[model samples]
Target: MSKQAVALTLTDLNADTPCCPPIAQRRIPAESAAVLAPAFKALGDPVRLQLMSMIASAPDGEICVCDLTPAFELSGPTISHHLKTLRDAGLVDSDRRGTWVYYRARPTIMRQLAALLTVEAT
Candidate 1:
């Protein structure tokens, strides 16, 4: 029997093109929902949510894992797992420099999420 290799690719959250119209404006298509649901699920965890805020608000547009670990009581590995979840969700990107790994928010995805949630005053 031959085994088939499945390749998985993440949606480019940083693309210039918008993923879809705002959720308030129209119903989201299944493909867009499939791509975005994981990102929302990743943020459903409080720790991951805070981590996302920190990475997004970092002055230099990125922050180191070493710096992020000290802010939480969780162990380094636990924090890393959460970061990995964010990475897989296409909400953030990471770079390793020596012993430290830095994370940067993908602003395009953030903007898309914000737009979807925005409710104009009637």
Candidate 2:
């Protein structure tokens, strides 16, 4: 391939203008580490991680709180609190349909997290 064509992919990948270089290449910047740290922090708890997976892998992209509560041995309020934490972190969305509240993973942030963690060898 031509030199110009060869450079295009690198340019396109760096187009986002990330503060840190790629994860495989260099240490992630403290600034970026700060921004994404919460996401990882939010997932640190086992209950929260399972909640995320349940929401992300749910059929129809959503699951009811009614269903989520029973799956865990915790109280309704505890599960609700965890769900709220995920919602506040911009990881999930909740909507009340009649009597029950349903939650779904936010795909935009999911994609961004996936892209950020993606390691493309130079």
Scored by lDDT, the top model is 1
Tens digit of lDDT per residue, candidate 2, span 19-82? Answer: 2454666776555565566666778799999999999999999999998999999999999999
Minimum summed lDDT over a 10-residue window in model 1 is located at 1-10
* Prediction 2 TM-score vs. true: 0.75
lDDT of each: 0.82, 0.75
Model 2 weakest 10-residue run by lDDT: 5-14
Candidate 1 regions exceeding 4 Å error are: 1-12
Q: Model 1, range 1-120, lDDT digits (tens) per residue?
A: 121211112344555666667788889766667667887999999999999999999999999999999999999999999999999888999999998789999888888777778777
Question: What would the TM-scores of all predictions be?
Answer: 0.86, 0.75
